[model samples]
Target: MKIQIEKEKLQAAYKNACGCVKDAFEKLFGEDVLETAKPTLDDYKTIKSYEDACDVLGLSPILSENRNKALCAQFPDHYDFRQNMPKHIIALMKLEIISRALWGKSFEPEPDAEGNKIYWYPWFALYTKDEVDRMSDEERKSLCGALFGGAGHGAYAGFGYLTADGRSSDSGADIGIRLCQETEEKAAYFGRQFIELWAEYLAYGFKVTEHLK
Candidate 1:
């Protein structure tokens, strides 16, 4: 059977999902959870001035500049100014969070031949197949939580802090929040109570109640 989710219900679901993630994050990292990473504008200034912000901050100044130019060329006003800047800012913040969480964590290379460490982005590559194979199930769960939880925080921050028109932080936040909620679900599936609830309340099915006018 199909289930319909009204606007209020959807909002409630979103809130519940966010709460689950926040709770899990607190349990893992302790009381000062969101404070684990704070964003800085130094990278923004550097990128605006055409410096190598990418090396330290995982942001490509050249790409960002090109994006700005393209956006200006297309939207020319508040559209460009409001949208891209917030997304980039949030991306940098997320990178910082990931970097801090991953520091000193053991992540080996692939192929058992190349000794190079894995690159942090794309998230899936956080652990190689071999590395995962070597880990106990509990260890694997912790790694999964670290990866998803950290990313979820970044996405959550983006959603909470950034405001933009189309393709706003909601996109990333939805993915991050869902992944985080799934962590709890996976724990439950394994007969553990790592988290109290599903990140999302509407996991079964939900249909839009109305279209935005």
Candidate 2:
């Protein structure tokens, strides 16, 4: 459940994965939708590590907290921006939705899917249908939960809407399993592979798949 891998590999791999998703996004969605995510990929150049990612996700929690009323009395300026989620975060959100769409599962989100403060946990579990179907729910939970122990900046472990509470109304494994494989498109291969490699590494480190029932 612990890791010693260099943050550089994770940083590079995440950007590559984002790039691949962006390519798919352009093909499936439109340039307008793609605009939100474009800046995030470029952000990788300077925001190059787990700590950096945490900071980025922490952009303005107040805007989203307490039904857009967290510490609002102190900062009236954020009132406008807090009306909706930040554009870049929405872009990342769309990326995840697109991953689900590839599997014929559509998402009509309504402030669901608590944002990942750690970033990687959301995308790191990307897996082809066969690849993830091979994993049981508990296995998937452990793998995604591997990073739960990370501290600071209000970081929590596990993927899905579950992070907001003790239970997962959405299935993390369902999201993890549905990816490129469903499309049968060649472009999906590398993206899927990059995700797969990191998944295996995390699984190894966390021992999630070592003893599956």
Candidate 3:
């Protein structure tokens, strides 16, 4: 089956999600909160790496506190700043992971050993189309649910490691679903949407839920 993505529709949905995040942030933290908390490039240069920036800037306390509060609102897990991972960095990680999983088809990654550069495939590309078609309705639903993972749910999905050959050696590997050549337009779309999605995630502390709004 030929895969087709509605780029215009996706753009609109991404814009709407941005708006939702903007509104939520403005309502909860005031309009200028981000500007107030903005970190400068000089500030970044003072730290050894992005992961350690929060520790140097004393942001670890507030960010980790808020994150743990958010997590506690949903789960019983209690998180601390001992690991040097800040909320903003974690937010960036979440955005990058979700965008790569969902919008990766828009760009072409480096080719694998077989000289195949599968662009624009879902993370769960392990199953063939025929295999997917053979599954019962209930099974398909469950599979899709698992593939989507904790994208919009209460938790965030963890990383899926790839081996040297770019194949899944572990359980949650990112074997792409769709394969196609990347275009300039698609690359631009991915770049723009990536920034928007990252900003939205930072502002609202949630995954995008309005895809077609």
Candidate 4:
């Protein structure tokens, strides 16, 4: 079926999903965890200067020169602004909510085979219900697994987040987020919940409307 989702319905579904995640974080960790990890919208910005790049989520220069050789080396394709910046920003927003859910608990630090620290991060992406239903399990893994930009790749089409176990986090920003679960059993339940949500709210729209048939 061609799943149709209304804008208000989609927004509501997302809000509920976010609430579920937020509650799960509180249940696993504590009430204050997500609150602390949540940042003001201004926290991340696309700026013209490389000096500010490190301090922001992304960088888009007012001047072409601002995205210098160093930034090109650092952020690669993402340093420059694109038509898809809004989508990218939205992904980052969802990531924050999910990451905050992970905050407050401590997971085991998984080291690489070489004993180097392997940083794991959650990879979240939104697909239409019809889009997700068309893909096989393997296809889903291959496609949505790492939709985020990797260390050196371009912003959109390169690679996504790193995963060691079922879930991961950057050791630098908030290690405790990964450790939010009070018990090891539920350590990374957020990953499962999001994947089951089946393209976030798109699935919910179908469920609520009984329109999947």
Candidate 5:
């Protein structure tokens, strides 16, 4: 004779299963942490393998043998979760939040009518040189806050380059209000903000830094 499981017991088991899955993901991916690495436009393109890219960026792979084993052992019911989920989902999420917070825009992926993926373009990479020059210094500073702010800020900036043509500051003003928020407590907040904004102008292939002064 087969024994029937109680409803409460089934619910508890399901909750435990989800917790185990989440814990397994954390252990396998190491909390989805971001690291800063200064990659030139070429470096971003040269790497053909994810392992190579991870090495260049000093990022550990979210799916390794040991991490996978830990996940499988902890969450037997959902051992295939990592494989089923796209690896870039976390990176995309981080980028989405940062992009929206800084640019007031979203990074939309280009797709065909059939819903097949085509390309991903960051909002900044689409800017014209004239547009970059037209933007105020305050706006540029916010986009490039990583250059002046801490490592986390730099990581965010580096991640921005993952999208097509992300290296060009001309498309999107890097500096503005976010930089102010990032360094509000510093004594030279205003000065640093200006400095960061100026750097972005220079990076955007500008000839006259004095235009803003």
Candidate 6:
């Protein structure tokens, strides 16, 4: 709900999270992708708290119903309500979760990290599927191109490692999930922690200011 954390602390935490995601990306893919993606505090800070971050980037509250309709019409063979859907929709959803974890909430599992009740954002599940029978090859290829640009291959392929279902993975679709998870989780953890640490830092700043007064 309401964040009691200080702004400066949150900012620092968010930055650290971004760095972690960036590092992961560099490790899995290469520095080239990170250089192009260039995820930053300003890009993530727009998403306020964990919940808001989750809803906006994780779930993608931005694209309206009309947009979906248009996408479906334009790519009829690839866009299937029952199957393919739009790639952007899925991308937005994954982004929201990453944002939530980094900016809004902490990663908490019921029993701990190894628990079955490990609640993950939606995109993690989506990328694990086999062929989207609903969409045509052209549609899938186009969606991949649009979402990933030049860095799509390695990122998409990396999802096979992240997901449980390795055999049924799509390179284009999985890359979005991999990148989002890498970025958002770090941002959320650091943002919340930074706030707590900043409170102490501010107390010292206040004392110094008060002495001057």
Candidates' C-alpha lDDT = 0.35, 0.40, 0.42, 0.38, 0.36, 0.40
Candidate 6 lDDT, tens digit per residue, 152-174?
A: 34344232333354443323344
Assess the local accuracy of residue 187 in candidate 5 as a C-alpha lDDT between 0 and 100. Answer: 13
Q: Superposing all C-alpha atoms, what RMSD in Å does each candidate have to the true structure?
A: 20.8, 17.2, 21.0, 16.1, 20.5, 22.9
Question: What is candidate 5's local distance difference test score?
Answer: 0.36
Q: Give the candidate number with the greatest TM-score.
A: 3
Give the distance in Å from residue 1's predicted Cα in candidate 1 to where it truly belongs.
71
Instruction: Show how many residue pairs clash in every candidate, following the order shown.
Output: 1, 0, 2, 8, 12, 17
Q: Which ranges of candidate 4 are over 4 A from the true structure?
A: 1-85, 105-115, 122-188, 196-213
Candidate 1 at 190: error in angstroms?
Answer: 37
Give the best candidate by lDDT: 3
By descending TM-score, how would the candidates be arranged? 3, 4, 1, 2, 6, 5
Q: Residue 208 of model 1: what lDDT?
A: 23
Q: Can you write out model 3's per-residue Cα lDDT over 21-111, one digit (the tens) per residue?
A: 7566557545443332333323322222222333333432223444444345644554555336654565555434433333322342553
Q: lDDT, candidate 3, residue 137?
A: 100
Query: What is candidate 5's TM-score against the reference?
Result: 0.18
Residue 150, model 3: Cα distance from true site in angstroms: 37
- Please tell me which model should have the higher lDDT, number 5 or number 6: 6
Show the lowest summed lDDT stretch of 10 residues, model 3: 41-50
Error of 4 at 60 (Å): 25
- Comparing 2 and 3 by TM-score, which wins? 3
Model 6 ranges off by over 4 Å: 1-157, 161-175, 178-213
| 1-213 per-residue lDDT for model 4 (tens digits) | 877656434433343455577566557545443332222223221111123332343323332333356547765656334334444343343434443434323333433434344344333334567887899999877765455334233221112234453233332322223323333333334434344332332232323222321
Error of 6 at 96 (Å): 7.7
